[model samples]
Target: MTRYVALGSSMAAGPGIQPRVAGSPRPAGRSARNYAHLVAAALGLDLVDVTYSGATTAHVLTDTQRGAAPQVDALDGSESLVTVTIGGNDVGYVPMLFAAGLPRPVRRIPLLGSKIRSLVNPAERYVALEEVGAALVEVGRTLRQRAPRATVLFVDYLTLLPPAGPASPLSDHDATLGRHLALELERLTAQAAATTGCGLVRAGAASRDHHGWSPDPWTTRFGWPVPRRPAPLHPNAAGMRAVADLVVAAASG
Candidate 1:
């Protein structure tokens, strides 16, 4: 049977959307419903889900929490395929941007601007992107070294802009920043894939039209709800299903 490994952050983890036991930290069940599981099941593959909530690329490379094991560990004696969805939380940029609102021209001022810019600026975001990309490359290289015959697939993040309705307070700016951030993430993903010889899967592009707050068959909310709690900005069940379909298609191809 083919063997597959999935590595990445909460999106990969499936959060509240993926059914789990009462106290289980990780999402329970196979990738059957989750994109990873869906792809693996379709291919009759053995899947090792190394995905964890709140995990960053650096954490995946180095951390040793129960749910968050090292990506390298998941690839030990790999078989046919390896898929990854990382680099979303490297510099804590997304959360920070969501908290700080959009990029206003006033934020360009030196002191306050530095503080806000640190939270909103594209340049600062790019720094985090670079770190994430480099880390992904390292993870890819290690996976290749460990699983020489496995096809390495790096999945990019989906877009989070153009929300659903009229611009709410701070929605327009946040959406704009989200668009730019999504593009930057794609660039980083492409760069890492190029360096690591991993097959690049543009999952983001697949969700572009359906992303944001608009009422679509694919998306649930706009700009992700606040409180950052159980079901915050991550994908809902429908979203996960869409993700699963795209990943299954990518894996089959």
Candidate 2:
């Protein structure tokens, strides 16, 4: 079988998903059914998924998290495919989104209070956009150099908020602002892909109608559960399958 490598953040690692893959870094929340796994299964590829829940671009290129090696370190010249879904954490997208969509009471909970407070009022809407874009470009360059023959792809983050107007929990102001930020990040992803000559899977655009509040949501909405949900405000199992199909189509295209 061909070798396939998956690298990214929680958006890709899929925390709280069912039946986690064994031998994966538990802290990374590697799911047995993440798009990478599904893509590998569909393509009959041997997968090395090192996607971490809190990963930033640094984690993909150079840094290690929870004792796991840098994501790019998993690559070798033998791999045939590599997919990367990252950058939201670098710009504090998901973190800030969670903070913005929460009730004041939930935001005040000690565990979430400090974290939310720290991000709720950043000087800018999205943090470090230029730097993150540069890092993403570097990630592409490194992947190409490391596995020259492999087909590298960049998968953008999925849609989390509704199109416009106030959905529950999010104020109208927040709803509009979130859309702008999501668009900015999606643009950044496309920019990175073009700059690095990497294939892109427009998961964000494809899920526009499937926001958490949509009739059929591919993402989980914000909720503070006692045990905490597997992937709050992130992609769900259906989303994973959708992404896997996208990956397969892109790979086979």
Candidate 3:
């Protein structure tokens, strides 16, 4: 039997996928519909899913949460495949990008406005990029050391917006800033993957046509309604399926 391990944050956890397991721990809101689960099912691989909702590279490498072992602990040299989509939380991209949606009046406050602007300033973005980039590099090194025979594949986050044009729910400015951040993240992830000799699944590009702006979106918009939980900027059921296909292909190849 092929041993497959899935690691990372909410993108791997599938937060809003219905029928969440009872007593499923926070951060690790593991859902059967997550791409990881779907991929495992499609490939007939034994899955050890340790994905959490808000994990950073640190959580995967050393930290533990909600009584779960560190993500790497879920790995052993016997593994045949490992898939992960991490690094976003390390740079605080999700929350900061959402800040773009602050009430119009609140965004007028000088101090707050200045802070938000600084958050996207080139220097700040570069610093964040460098920090997360280094963490991902470390992740690659550690995974190789820990799972010597495993094929490590680092997946990128899905596209949250279109290439051009303002998407609903975000001010044009915010939409532009969000796209910029996503681009930076992809660059960092690709760089790390190349450095580590790991496979890369460009989930962002694969899901580009299904961005929130699309008539048939794979991912949820910032404030789209989701039953029983706050809207997370995560892949919906369709998005999960799309990602699973990509992952399955990579693992099989």
Candidate 4:
């Protein structure tokens, strides 16, 4: 079987998805049903999934996360395919959403509360777009160097907010800001793929109409995990399968 290595954050890891990958680090939230596994099954590839939850661009390119080595270290020049989905954490997407949901008084608590408060403070500066784009370009180039035979592709995050709607649980203000951030991430990710001559799986573009509030949601909205509620602010199982289809198409094309 051809070797395929997967890298990125929770968007690729699929936290709370059933049946965790055996021997995989629990902290990484390596779901057996994540898009990489689905794509691997569909394409009959030997998969090396090193995706982790809460990963930033730094985690992917250079920094260790939760005692694990940098995600890129999983490569060994023998793979035929590599898929990456990162940058959300770096841009404060999840952290911002999570902070928005906390009660005002709750945000005033110590330690974790302070961190959460900092994420949503309007005065705090987000990561620059160019820096993320540059990091992604470097990721693609490094992966190509480490696995020259592989087809490296950057899979941007799935659409989390509706194009035009009142994204519930999020204030109207936060909804709009979230939408803008998502678009920016998508734009830069595409640019990064182009910069490095890597293929792109257009998950964000294709899933725009399938945002969390849509009739058929690809992603879960911010809410408690009841039977009906999906994982607050992450891709759903449907999203994972759809992403796999996108990857299959990109890789095959």
For each of the candidates, the C-alpha root-mean-square deviation to the true structure, in angstroms, is 4.7, 2.2, 2.5, 2.1
Q: What ordering of candidates by lDDT runs from best to worst?
A: 4, 2, 3, 1
Clashing pairs in 2: 16-230
**Sort by TM-score, best first: what order?**
4, 2, 3, 1
Candidates 2 and 3: which is better by TM-score? Answer: 2
Tens-digit lDDT track for model 3 on 90-117?
Answer: 7767766666655656656889877766
Candidate maximizing lDDT: 4
Q: Lowest-lDDT window of 10 residues in candidate 3?
A: 224-233
Worst 10 residues of 2 by lDDT: 222-231
Kindly report which residue stretches of model 2 are placed more than 4 angstroms away from their true locations once superposed. Answer: 105-115, 225-229
Task: Rate residue 128 of model 2 by lDDT.
Answer: 67
Which portions of model 4 miss their true places by more than 4 Å?
Answer: 110-114, 122-125, 128-130, 225-230
What RMSD does model 1 have? Answer: 4.7
Candidate 4: clashing pairs of residues: none
43-126 per-residue lDDT for model 2 (tens digits): 999998889999988989889888878888898789899999988888887777778877777767887787776666645545
TM-scores of all predicted structures: 0.79, 0.92, 0.90, 0.92
Candidate 3 vs candidate 4, TM-score winner: 4
Clash pairs, model 1 backbone: 31-37, 31-38, 32-37, 35-244, 164-214, 213-222
What TM-score, to 2 decimals, does candidate 4 have? 0.92
